[model samples]
Structures are given as structure tokens and as C-alpha cells.
Target: MVCVFAIALLLLGPNPAKAESREQAVDRLTDYLFYRVNSQLNNRKLQTDDREYIRQWQRLREAIDPRVKSVQEVCLRVSPQEKGWEFTTINGETYEQTYDRLADTIFYSRHPQRTGQPIPTNDKIGISEWSAIRREMFLSNCGL
Candidate 1:
């Protein structure tokens, strides 16, 4: 059903005289890509484990940018094989982020280069090396 709607919308692009807003486009994109019941972000409705991951990411953002007063909204960019989230402020800055719950690590592209080394190709970061990169990102990008 969503695929059908998406195809129709694409075939008939937004009215040239009046464009759809950014939020509308994102909502449409989410629907087109995934089929699921809309999930709410209420903390009381979440499991303990799920809440812990949320806390971790919240802490990460604070460590990165303490001046961020409030987050207006979040959007998830999902694929069948992987998932990530985007946080946006009212001021229009977006932080595209992904978290690995098992490894307890977060990846964001704010700082592409790892400290003290040339960025490597085909890098696979896991628990062992997460600390170094985490520290590098915190110091360089996050205000920590």
C-alpha cells in the first residue's frame, strides 16, 4: 500500500507552485521504506533494556554538545540489514547517529577522522577499539 502511494507521489512530483515541507517529505519517506505500527517514544512504555540504550545515547549527545537546549524531533533511517537515527534541533542542525547495544558504542559522522591515524578503509569497529575512537570523538567533537 505504501509502495503504491510512494510510486504515485514520485510519478507526480510535489506541486511546483507549492512544495511539501521537509517534515512531510520525511514522513512520506519513512512510510515508503518500512511497514510497521507507529512506535511511541514514551519512556514509561519502554522496557528497562530499551530505556538504558536511550540513556546512553542521551549522554552521548550531552557529551558532544552541552549547549544543545532541546531536541525537537528524531527520525530513524532504517534498512533491512541495519538501522540508525537522526536527531534534529529547532535550529536545523542534525546529528546522524547509530548505536550498537551489544558493544555499547555509538557511531556518528561528525568527526570522520580517528585521532592519531589516517582514516582507514574497510574498518570494522567493535568493543576492543571502541574506547579509543570514543575518546577521540569526545575530545575533538563533543566538548568533552
Candidate 2:
């Protein structure tokens, strides 16, 4: 009985691995927003006016803003894939944006790049602008 209790205590002991801090969480949320915005833009088969795009951007901003304080200082890394893009923030969080051009569907996954580097490709997409827009939305919604 004592041996079983000792083993359980060892299993329940505080994990040595450090959990992600709050700043890391904020960065992750920012990266996710960026990927989502890019995917949405790429998958809109019908040409959307600036106003409609802005509305969509606002919705995404609202969805992620509450979880983070500031987006301006967020550092982003973007890599274009065959069908879309993948993004990561300086805090080590990552996400992917895949656009189904045929079906006009946008798929987003948080931390899709956690296990490996993004696939190599030469496809160029408007990554900087998307990152900027994400930062702006985050700042506006979070008052930062």
C-alpha cells in the first residue's frame, strides 16, 4: 500500500516542464488571427469590397482581442504553402491557413506547425499586409 502511495505521489508531483506564460498565450492568439485573416481573404471567391473585408476583419479582431493586450509588438513569421500560408509568432506559437480555392472554404488550425517546419514552397502571398492588418485589429480592439 505504501509503495502504491509513493508511486502516485511521484506521478502527481509538479511537472518540471515549464508551461507557457501569459505573454506566450497572447502571441499565440495573435498568430492564429493572422492565419485566419489571410485564409479568409484568399478563399473569398467572390470579389469582396473593402468594406466587406473590413467587416470580416473586425469580426476576427473581436474574436481574438479579448485574449490579448497588444498586437503591435507581436512579431510574426509567415511561410506560404501550396494552397495557403502558415504563420508563427515570436513566442513560439504557430498556425496554418489553407484555402480551398475550388470550394472557397478557409480552414484554420492553431499550432499546426508545432511539430515541424512549414513545407518549402515558392508561392508568394501578401503576408506583410496581413500581419499589419492583424496587428492593427488587435490594437484597436484591445485599446493597445
Candidate 3:
């Protein structure tokens, strides 16, 4: 469904006359993608053990990596697959974006209200790494 919607958007092109706001587009895109990923995670959790579940989650990146880059190009106008493209997010907040941040905005919202979100990635960071980043940030911010 998201792919179909994305494809429709690409085919239709920007309707400068009466288009939805950019912020609305960003929220719709990210929210739809996040919901899909999380829904898959929930289903995978039922069928696999912890290690396997994490593996499946990370494997998702391999498939989505391209679609995401396409979004950056077609929908986002951020240059095709440009790793450092930045953009505004849902709540009038913005981030100096990278491929990872654009893909993981849900996990790293500018005004994130949750804590200790499990970092999901492909051949990249994991719980241990997230823990280190979390603790290091805490200590660095409250330094001696």
C-alpha cells in the first residue's frame, strides 16, 4: 500500500497548485513506513526467538534501503541517494539529516518523549551500542 502510494506520488508529480503541505507529506511518509516496519516486527516476534527477531528486523534495511533513497530523490527533492540531505519533520522540528536519520526518524525524534528505544539496524549498532551511546551522552552532558 505504501509502495503503491509512493508510486502514485511519483507518477503524479508535484501539484504546485493545491498540493498538501510538505510537513504533511513527511509525516505521512514516515508514519506509514514506521507502522509497516513495527507491524512486521510484532509479527516476527511471535514466530522467532529474540536473536532471530533482531536479525529479521535488521534484514529489513536491505530491502528498504533503496526505496528510502528513492523517497529522498523523488518525494524529498534531496538529490538522489544523497547521504547528508536534511529536511523538516512532523512537529515543525528539523534535523540535519543523513540516510540513517531520515530512515530512523521515529527512533530519534527531535523532541523524543520515550527513552532507551532499541536501536534496529543492518550490520550496524545494536542494544549494546545503543546502551553505549545512551550512557556516553548522559555522562558527557553531565560531565565532571
RMSD per prediction, one decimal?
A: 15.3, 17.8, 15.5
Better of 2 and 3 by TM-score: 3
Worst 10 residues of 2 by lDDT: 98-107
Highest TM-score: give the candidate number.
3
> Which candidate tops lDDT?
3
lDDT by residue for model 2 over 22-123, one digit each (tens)? 555544554454445555556444344665444444444444444343233333332232121112222333322211110111111222232133323442
| Winner by lDDT between candidate 2 and candidate 1 | 2
Q: Please give the range of 10 consecutive residues that has the lowest summed lDDT in model 1.
A: 31-40
User: What lDDT score goes with residue 89 in model 3?
Assistant: 30
Candidate number with the higher lDDT (2 or 3): 3
Compared with the true structure, model 1 gives a TM-score of 0.22
**Clashes in predicted model 3:** 0
TM-score of each: 0.22, 0.23, 0.25
**Candidate 1 lDDT over residue span 1-144, tens digit each:** 999999999889876454444444444333321111112343234357765445544444443242222112232333444322222334443332321211122333223244234335456553335544333331111111
Pairs clashing within candidate 1: 64-142
CA RMSD (A), model 2: 17.8
